[model samples]
Target chain A: MRYFNNPEALLRLVSSMQEGFAITLTIFFATLLFSIPLGMVIALLRMNRHRAVSVPVSLYILVMRGTPLMLQIFAIYFAVPMLTGHNLERMTATILAFSLNYAAYFAEIFRGGIMSIPVGQYEACRVLGMRRSQTFFYVVLPQVFKRVLLPVSNEVITLVKDTSLANVIAVGELFRAAKNEASRTASIEPLFVAGLFYLIMNGLVTLFFNRLTQRMSYYRD
Target chain B: MLEATHIRKSFGDTRVLKDVSLRVSRGEVVAIIGRSGSGKSTLLRCLNDLETVDGGEIRIGGQALVTMQAGQPVYKKDGERRALMLKMGMVFQSYHLFPHCSVLRNLTMPQKLVLGRGDGEAEAKARDLLAKVGLSDKAGAYPCQLSGGQCQRVAIARALCMDPDILCFDEPTSALDPQLTQEVLGVIRRLAQEKRTMIVVTHEMRFARDVADRVIYMEDGVVVQDGPAQEVLGDHRSDAIRAFAGE
Candidate 1:
């Protein structure tokens, strides 16, 4: 209560947590950067005709989605080093685990989007003599993006909170900093401040996605 | 300009097209009319390589798109088939306009991507075809903003932008309201007047009678009658065709 009453202490608390906030943001952005494109490739592979290719991709998605993300982080951090005899940095393992888990989710979302397009769209491209690559990248992908936007926004917001899971592996992320400060000060004020930080971050994400949705507003089914 | 012989297609146990054959000369407007599941659309699709024929031969503009070999249909090599397929353009019943693209981009992008036309050439051709379809003002508009009839006209214009040697319409106006159907039929009438080679699969008896030079009627996947449009529709000899023509 004394620390909560002191404005100077609150200011210090916020400043001290800035590094953890930065690490959280880094993990969030880096995960999106790597996972989104990886998800698209995985979606394509999952939709492949060959069972050998699609079945393995399906199993990968199943494992990632079925398991807890915290366990995944632990496996990457502890088990990988034990098996490979080379230790991964805590940050690297956290990012890798988040990316792989998120990519499975995004792949399923993208596959649904791709499949939602009518067969007529592809037939139109075919009769127009469009090459397969041109048809997919130009005609199909834009439509898929339009269809998948809302679900993707939901997943992205979930990812924001999921980033806090990184503290399990002691990655020094935002939640970890708040927890440490709360134990030392014996007050919950720092944790409240961390919640504010998360709200601000997700607020920006929501704003960005809203703009994207508006830009595609002209497209209608 | 287009020929198919013994064209047979099957979907699992059901035979959709059984030994269907057609021959269309240059600049001739041939209309194929049949009931649903009569294989009219499937035959048009086969001519355009949208669907592979199970057994038969399809030749467009003296280029063989597919030929029968070992009791199965063999398509030309990829590049050769694509080149041959480009000789024809198709307007679908649903319009099938790329919903994300502007009306102009729907016409222009395919030209630029498939034909490697420069921006200036593509835009000029797109504008010309849009004007031809009486939709010059809608170039910047998206497909969703247009009425069903207007979308179909844009689809016709998109096909014409390619300067195809032959054009195909798969029931172009069947999806439209009766009022909207006439506007699209008017566009097709104009194209026929221009002497463009076109093969149409349609349900409109009057449009087929007035616009088509030749009418081919099908039933249960076989051509029931093939003759001049007046003779086929006005044929007193075949009761089935007379009933189909609403005589």
Candidate 2:
């Protein structure tokens, strides 16, 4: 209470946590950057009619989705280092784990979106003499993005909170910084401020996705 | 303009088309009519390469799209096949327009992408076809914003924008109510009067009798009757054909 009550002290505390907040944002953006496209590729491969291509992708998705994300983080950070006789940087390990886990979930969502498009759409493109690539990029993918926006928005919100899980491995993200400050000052004020940070970040995320959804509402499947 | 001979297709163990054959000269309108499981649609699909015939030869616009090689059907190389297929356009039972695109864009995008037409040319042709289908005012509307009949008309205009030599409709009015069906049939009727080559797979008995120069009736995966429309639908036909005609 005494620490938070002092304006200078509160300012110092917030400034100190800024580095950790940036790290959290970095994790969030990096995970999404790698995961979204990777998920699309995986989803396409999963839909392949041949077993040789699809079987391994389905198993990979199963393992990634069936296991706990924290355990995945631990394995990538600790177990990989031990098995390879080399250490991964904490941030690299954390981002890698987060990207891989989120990609599995995104893959499933994309699969549903792609599958929901009717066969007639493909036939229409086919008889029009459009190439397969043209059919996918122009005719199919835009509709897919519209259909999967709600589920994708849900996953994005979950990702904002999931960034805090980095603290389990001492990655010193915003939540970890606030945890350290709370202990140092023997006050819960820092923890509440951390909660505020997460809320504000998630609020911005919600706003961005809501605007996207609104822009696309003009078209319907 | 189109010739298919000895077309045979099967799904697993069930034969959907067994030795079906048809030929259409330029400026011909052929209506393929039959009961639900009689493979009428399958034969039309085979012509358009929507369904590959297990064994057959298909020639469109005097170019071979597929030929019987040994015991199986072998399609032409991809580039050649696509160019040949571009001479034909297909409209589905359900209007499968790109819902995200306006009616004008739906008609123009394929021309730009597939034919490499300039935007000016594509848009000009799109507007012309839209007017032809009585949809000039609805150019900016999305498919979902239009009624069933309006959407079907837009689909016809979209297919026409490509300047296909033979237009194929797979039960174009099966998904429409009678009123909506007439609006679509009216567009087809106008196209027929202009002497556009077309093949329609439909259940509309009167439309087939009136509009189709030749009617090919299918039953149990084989051509049961094939002749001039009036001759087949008029007197001197089998009881099966009479019963199918509902008289």
Candidate 3:
């Protein structure tokens, strides 16, 4: 409560945390940008008829989902360096680990969405003389995106919080900064401020997704 | 013109089409009628390359779609097959309109993507086809927002937008009620008046009798009767056709 007595100190705490918050935003955006499209490709590969192709994709998903994110972060940041003899920057390792892990979950979500689409859509596309790629990209992807929006949003919101796990490898994101500030000032107020930042970010994300779902409500199966 | 000769198709050990053959001249409307699982739909599907024939030759506009190669029916390459398929259009029993797209887009996208039409041209053609099908007012609406009849009309317009040389309908009104079926059959009748080449696989014998110049009856995967609509439906000699006509 005494921390509120000094508005200047609070302002300084917020301003200092800006750099850490920027890193968190970077990880969040980069993970989403890479994971979503990568997830689509992974889903297509997983759906392949040849067992040779799908088996490897299945194994990848199993391993990524079965392991803990914290361990994956450590493995990417530390174990990768030990194995390859090239040290990955902490931020790079964090983004890579998060993208790969999240892509697996998103891939399954996409697969379910894509499969749920009635087979009639594909037959219609074929009879229209649309190419296989056209059928997927034009006729199929939009519906799949609409169908998987809720689940994808769930992963995205979780990702906003998951970015904090990057601190295991010393990536200076928002939570790490808040923890440092709280200890240095010997007060828990900075932690509360950090929580406020997360809530606001997630609030915006939810609003955007809700708007998207509404826009797509014009069509139903 | 469309020609499918001696077509043979089987699903596993169960043969669906056995030595089915038919030909349609330009601007001809042929109706295929049969019982369920009698291969009426299967035969129409083969003409559009929706289902491959185990043995047969399918030629569209004098272009070979499928040819006999070493005792098997070999389809043309993908590019060639696509070009051939473009010459013919199909409307399905379920309509199968892209549910996520507006009625206008259902007609326009295929034109733009497959036919390489410009946006303005595609839209213009789509609007014209919509008007033809009497669904111009529903252009901006999604298929899911339309009734079964409206969806089928939109589907017909979608196929017409491609400017195909032939059109195929796989039970275009099988899913519609009596009133809705009338709306859809009206559109087909209009197309028939315009001399659009169409092959409809239908169970509506009355509509088939009225709209189709030729009627082909199928039973157990073979053509049991093929003749003028009046001769086949009105005075059919086949017992299966009599039974199917509910005589």
Each predicted complex: what DockQ?
Answer: 0.92, 0.90, 0.79
Candidate 2 or 1, higher DockQ = 1
Better of 2 and 3 by lDDT: 2
Q: Which ten residues in a row have the lowest lDDT in candidate 2 chain A?
A: A1-10
What is the Å distance of residue B158 in model 3 from its true position? Answer: 1.0
Q: After superposition, how far is residue B16 of candidate 3 from its true place, in Å?
A: 1.2
DockQ of 2: 0.90
What's the C-alpha lDDT at position B225 in model 1? Answer: 91
Q: Put down candidate 3 lDDT per residue, B190-234, tens digits, no spaces.
A: 999999899999999889889899999999999999998998887
How much lDDT does candidate 1 score?
A: 0.93
Pairs in steric clash, model 2: none
lDDT of 3 by residue, A1-221 (tens): 74668899889999999999999999999999999989999999999999999999999999999999999999999999899999999999999999999999999999999999899899999988899999999999999989999999999999999999998888999999999999988999989999999999999999999999999898887
Give the per-residue lDDT of model 2 (tens digit) for B25-94: 9899999989999998888888888888899899987889889878888999999988989999899899
Q: What is the interface RMSD of each candidate, in Å?
A: 0.6, 0.6, 0.8
Which CAPRI tier for candidate 2? high
TM-score of each: 0.98, 0.96, 0.94
Tens digit of lDDT per residue, candidate 1, span B86-178? 999999999999999999999999999999999999999999989988999999999999999999999999999888999999999989999
TM-score preference between candidates 2 and 3, better one: 2
How much is B226 displaced in model 2, in angstroms?
0.8
Candidate 1 positional error at A148, Å: 1.1
Ranking by lDDT: 2, 1, 3
lDDT of each: 0.93, 0.93, 0.92
